[model samples]
Target: MEGGLRRMSHHPRKRVEKAVGALNLAHLQGAFYLLFLGCGMAFILMVWESFMDVF
Candidate 1:
């Protein structure tokens, strides 16, 4: 257990932790809202087959 604990310095996990800590709540909320809007637009376009070649 002691040896495993010492070897747990994974680089990607540390970077992700840093990034998560640095985010602003207001910006995150706005990003999510824009993502939701984009997905809704995509769904509508897909259903209507607006751009058959691109889709």
Candidate 2:
């Protein structure tokens, strides 16, 4: 029984580590996507503003 518990404990620790790694990767991907979206929107806005000024 003790040996079984010890082995099970190792599995949970490994699972937790994997979950944390996945969460970090998700956060990084989301941040990069948001940054790209923001940059694109800003560029569009700048172009629109310049067009308005020209008119």
Candidate 3:
């Protein structure tokens, strides 16, 4: 019974670690997506401005 309890405690700790890692990955992905979107928008705006100048 004591060994079982110890084993159960370790599983929860592992689960907590996995959850934290998943959250960090999600945060990194969000930041990357935002950066990508910002860059794309900036590129589009530059192109539009150049076109306007030509016209």
Cα lDDT, model 2, residue 46: 100
Q: In model 2, which residue pairs have backbone atoms overlapping below 3 Å? A: none
Arranged by TM-score, best first: 3, 2, 1
Q: Evaluate residue 15 in candidate 3 and report its C-alpha lDDT on the 0 to 100 scale.
A: 97
Per-residue alpha-carbon lDDT of candidate 1 for residues 1-55, written as tens digits (9 for 90 to 100): 8777666767668888877866666678989999999999999988788567666
Residue 52 in model 1: shift from native, Å?
A: 9.4
Best by TM-score: 3
| Per-residue lDDT of candidate 2, residues 1-55 (tens digit) | 9999999989989999999999999999999999999999999999999999999
Find the 10 residues in a row with the least total lDDT in model 3: 5-14
Model 2 regions lying over 4 Å from their true place: 1-6
Candidate 3: stretches off by over 4 Å: none
Worst 10 residues of 2 by lDDT: 4-13
lDDT for predicted candidate 1 compared with the true structure: 0.82
User: TM-scores of all models?
Assistant: 0.47, 0.74, 0.89
lDDT of 3 by residue, 1-55 (tens): 9999999989989999999999999999999999999999999999999999999
Per model, how many backbone clashes are there? 0, 0, 0
Residue 38 lDDT (model 3): 100
